[model samples]
Target: MDNPMKSSFWMLCILIDLWPYVEDNLTQLQCNLFSIGPGEYFRSLVAQQKTHLWTQRNLCDSPNDAHDRYISNHLFAQLVDRHCIDDRGPIKLFCDDFRPQNIIVDPTTLGIKAVLDLEFTTAMPSQFASEPPWWLSLAGPDSYLVRGLTLDHFVEAYMYEPRLDQFLAAMEQAEKTHPAAEHHKPLSRLMRESWRSKRFWFNYAARKPFDIDDIFNDCLKDGNASIESLDEETRAGLDAFVEAKMKQLKAYDTDCARHLESAG
Candidate 1:
């Protein structure tokens, strides 16, 4: 693993080997691990994270913020309904805080000795693991600062990263020879599409919580559509959903502040 490409290729191989065992271990507890239950847990977690970040950034007042929120929720709900919750496929382990800093490597060989920081790791839909890791580009969502280039731009640029091709090639070989070739094939296709469509951002946002605003806005921009394009009935429903969600977030924040004040 002297080269980054080699290291990443090996990482994917390890992940493929671990996928089945992790899914088997977590299948029973998946429903009970999160307070809201497995199906709704990620959704609720994302909403809570987005609410906190939105409040912290004072983004609630931005024009079209409500629309953005609505679209974000809408897209998220659709994804969850279609691909996430209730999928019978093997679940994959997701480590939210994975980055280069968390990886321990042998200095001479550059081989990965160990991966640390599994504190936030949990089982999630296999499709999640199918998407490319954000660290493949060695950049986070916030690093794309050029006016026109956003997260999608970073993903597109990273597509040409030498390591990604190596990783995918390794995955393809695994698909052909692995006992779980059927499983690996679908994930391989998904990873490619996720990269091409930049759906990786949506998957990332679904888990990152705090990044919902930035990711959602970028998604809307990529789609090249606006709130006005939504049908009248859909718009009405989304408006109502946004209003209620905003009110709930404000109340939760106010309660937390009052409790802090009393403690002080």
Candidate 2:
């Protein structure tokens, strides 16, 4: 049997590296917005007269940063909806045609010696955080985006706006309870040192909109492989399958609209 973690596997893995509350909120909002509730009213208001949907007055359609914001927010929303924000299980999506190369090394050698140097090849994108070890490059000519949790300082700045002192107070209590926990260091100290360096800024930038495109392009260029290199029959089959799935989704949405209209 073909292993799922091989070179020909295009997999998406969800890391528990995002803000749980923000993720929860986005999930709730998206679910409610698409369901048969107040969200219906909100969508109607935004799409009213069709002209309103495209007008600058639409809050969600702010022209200045709409595209980037949409992409960022959409990623967050998908993460939340798929994983329920803190369930602590890794979710994997399989892509037969989306083969990614993977690199695994012997922990003892730190990857310096010769061991196959490549496994079928699976590319796993690093979360927008720390870089995976250098060994991953040997897997194959594939790309994976890097992503991870925003450091505490970045969260404090624009992401979470809690009273700083109050948050530190809680961290203090947590430290006491978990005594030896890695994060047991006083929150007060962490806060003081947090924004003092490039640690947090570097992390924030990894997930930033401009950085994503750059990372993707870098991987594509480094791979030196063309889409034409894939098995042609497999590529054709994937295109047809995608088209069919999209048609099914459209039909489902149309049916949902008709049901809602009739009920209303």
Candidate 3:
């Protein structure tokens, strides 16, 4: 099927080329520059050659890093032409699997920190039954300037949605061996429990906790993923649920603080 969007994009580019004076509009110039032609020649060149340039320039020796840089460079180059902000970086959209968050403690202050970011923009819907990538400021110590393991790297990791099965398996293992195992639970189980636990407030209930599983399976049927990929709609719904739950939890915490202050 022809991509009407792609065709429209090319048409816009041609229009821009025909009227270069329109370059006065920075945004229009950006769009024209990034616009992939009908033949996709520039895009192909970036995919095949300039990608190697980025890889070599960055000294990205890892196969994964090289591939990610290539994609990022192509996407970024497109952004330069279109003058659009592409928040999704190379690592986030390319990584295949991610491990469950293992909390790290700051030795000096004894502060416990969770690695997962509270907000993550998802792609490919694979994180439905698994824990998404988390961010970490340090590696369980006061270490600084680690190679590519910074807060920025953490956010980029989530762009490449990891498989649900892989996330689930990590959660299972984490629940067994992680120091904070109590915080670990399968994503599906967590959702069901949250639904169950908040039934009084939400004023709803599934026939059983297992019903959530059935619903997930049914949703997956229409989705273009393996057993592990979450459909975009499902992921979005899950994100909404999470946001609501977070708000509820915050309210409860506030109430508890008030009660304690009054008691004291």
Q: Evaluated with TM-score, which candidate comes out highest?
A: 1
Over the full model, what C-alpha lDDT does candidate 2 score relative to the true structure? Answer: 0.33
Which lDDT tens digits does candidate 1 get at residues 109-142? Answer: 9999999998989777666777876676777655
Better of 1 and 3 by TM-score: 1
Clash counts for all predictions? 0, 22, 11
lDDT of 3 by residue, 1-264 (tens): 987865665455435333433333344335555444422422333343332332222233344443333333333333222211122321122122233354466878878755444344323212222223222222311121134243233224433223334554666676566444454544545534433333211111011121222222222122443312434553344434434445544554465456546645
Local accuracy of candidate 2 as per-residue lDDT tens digits, 113-178:
333423333321222112111122222112223333222322333333244445556766876776
lDDT of all predictions: 0.61, 0.33, 0.34
Order by TM-score, highest first: 1, 2, 3
> Per-candidate TM vs. native?
0.59, 0.21, 0.17
C-alpha RMSD (angstroms) for model 2: 22.9
lDDT (Cα, 0-100) at 168 in candidate 2: 57
